[model samples]
Target: MLEAARTTPTALWNDSSDLSELKQSIAFGGVGATCNPVIAYSTIKKHLDVWRPRIEAIAAANPTWGESQIGWQAVRDMSVEAAALLKPIFDEHNGRNGRLSVQTDPRFHRDAKALADQAVEFHGLADNIVVKIPATKVGIEAIEDATYRGVSINVTVSFSVPQAVQAGEAIERGLVRREAEGHDVSRMGPVVTLMVGRIDDWLKHVVARDKLFVDPSALEWAGVAAIKRAYEVFQARGLRSRVLSAAFRNVLQWSELIGGDLVVSPPFKWQEIINASGYDVVEKINEPVHEHYLEELNRIPDFRKLYEVDGMTIEEFEDFGPTRKTLRQFLEADADLDALVRDILIPAP
Candidate 1:
C-alpha cells in the first residue's frame, strides 16, 4: 500500500517559504503543501530581507492601511510563491496532487459570506491554491458557497465524525449546484482535515487531572481510533471530499492508516521518522476501536460524543472537545503573527 501510495502523490503540512525544504518534500513523495499564519509569519521573519521590500512597497501604496493588513499582504505574497513552486506537479497530476492550502483568517471563521469571499480571493492567488476553511457551522456554509462558485477548499479544524459529515455534505451540495450550472466537477478538490495527536493530548490531560482509571494503552490509541472511525464514516457515506490525516504525533499514527483513501500530511520530523523506519506494507489499520478504550472514553460526557460518530447535534459539534481548543490555538497564532507584522511594518521610532 505504501508503494502504491508512493506512485500517487502525498501532501506535506508545513510552511511553503523554504524552497529547499519544499523541494526535498517533493522528492520524498510530497506533491502538495499547506500553509497557515504561523508558517506565513515564521517565513517572513526568517526572510526579512526577501520580504521587506515587498512589504515596504505595499505600505507605500496603501499608507492608510493598518499594520495587520500590511502583514497579511506579506503572507499572501508568500502563499503565491509557494503555489508557484507546486504548479507543475498540480498540472501533472491534473488537479489531484500539487495543491496548496492557505487558511482564511480565524476572525472570520464564523462568517460564511466572509469566508466564501476570502476563499475566492485566495483562489485568485494561484491555480493550485485551495483556500483552507475552518469546519465551524458557518465555515461549512462557506464551504458550500465556495464550492458552488467553483472554488476549491481545504476544510480544517474538524475533529468529530459528524463535523466531517457536515463538511462532506457541503462540498457535495456545492458540486451538485455547479453541475446544474453546466460546470465540470472533475477538477474540484476538497479535503476534510481530521486532526490526530491533539485528541489524545487532550485526553491525557483529562485522565491526569480527573485521576481516571482509564488504561494507558487505551489513551494512546484514542487519536488513531477516532481518525479511523471518521474514515469509516467517510467511506460509508461515499462522500467526494477526501480525508486528510493531520497533526500526527508519532510513527504509528503515520503507519496505521496507510492503505486507505485518505491523504496523510505528517510533519517534517515525523516524515523523517517514517522514512527512517523503512516500513513498506500498505495494510488496513481501520479496526474497530478497542473495547476498553471505548468503555473508558465513555466515562467522560464530552469524550463520549467524540468516541461515537452519531448522537451529536450540529451545535454540539462546535462545542466538542478539540474543536474549541484548536480554534483558540489558531486565534492565538494569528494574534502572534499580527503582532509580528505590526513590529515589522511600523518599527518603534
Candidate 2:
C-alpha cells in the first residue's frame, strides 16, 4: 500500500477526521480526508473522553447557540484540525489532493440556497476544506452555485452514473461561470463521490425484497462495475470533476478503483487490511468488467439505474431508491449528533 501510494497516479484518502487515523493514513500516502454527518457523529461517539469536554466548552462559550449549532461547531473544529494535517500535502499537490471535506446540514437538502450558503461558511474554515453537497435535484443547482462562489465541492449521497454525469456537468457550468467572471478556478478541486458500496447494499436490499435470481456472490462486483461505467462516462465527457470511490464494503471497493487521477478513500481499518494484504497496485482504471457479471447484475432494475448513464433523470435523483435512503441516513446522523450535544448541554438524571 505504501509503495502503491508512492508509485501510482491514484490517490488514497482517509474517510475519517480522527487525528490518529489521519496521521496513520498520511504516513501511508493518503492526501485527503473527509467527514460527513454520520462520520462526524461516529468520530465523537468513539472518542467521548476527548470530545465530551470540548462539547461542554463549546456550549458554554456560545450560550445562545442551540444543540445543532454547537454540534456543527464541533464538526467544524474537527475539519479544521484534519485540514491542518493535510495542508502540506495540499500545497505540494495543489488543490486536486489533500482536502478535508466537511458536509453541510443534511436537513437543508431541499434548499439549494441554504446548502450553498453553508458551503461558503465551511469553505472559509480552511483553505483545503472541501464542502460536500448532496446530489439532490436542488443540490445540482447548489453545486453550480457554490462552485461559482469558489467553494471546492464533493458531491455526496450520490450513487448512479446519471448522478455522476450531472454532477460533473454542474461543476463544469460553475467553473465556466467563474472563468467568465475572471475568478481564479485553478485552486478549486471538485469531486463527485460514487458511494459504490452503498449502491451494492441497495441492490442487496432489492434482491431480498424482490427475490431476484441474481447470483449473490457476483453482487460484490456491482460497485466496481458501476464505478468503471461512471469513470468511462467521465472520461468520454472530459469532465473536470473526478469520480471518487467511497463507502468501502470490501477491498475491491477501493482496490479496483485504484489508478488514474481519481481518488479511493477507505476507512483507516480498511487501509490497514489493504496494506496487510500486500495487494499489487496495478493500473486497472481502464480494465473492463467481466461480461458475465454485468449480464447477471443487469437482471436487477436498481443495478441498471446505477450502471446506465441515463438510468435516472434529473427529476428522479432525489427519489431514487439509494439517494432517498442515504439522505435519510445522513439526516438521522445529524439528529443523532444533536442529541449527543444535547446530552452534554442538559445531562439527564
- The TM-score leader among the candidates is 2
Candidate 2 stretches with Cα past 4 Å from truth are none
After best superposition, candidate 2 residue 185: deviation in angstroms? 1.1
**Alpha carbon deviation, residue 248, candidate 1 (Å):** 1.7
Q: 15-75 in candidate 2: lDDT tens per residue? A: 9999999999999889999778899999999999999999999988998999999999999
Which whole-number lDDT from 0 to 100 does residue 30 have in model 1?
Answer: 76
Task: For candidate 1, list the clashing residue pairs, or say none.
Answer: 1-282
Worst 10 residues of 2 by lDDT: 252-261
**lDDT of residue 290 for candidate 1:** 67
Q: What's the lDDT for candidate 2? A: 0.90
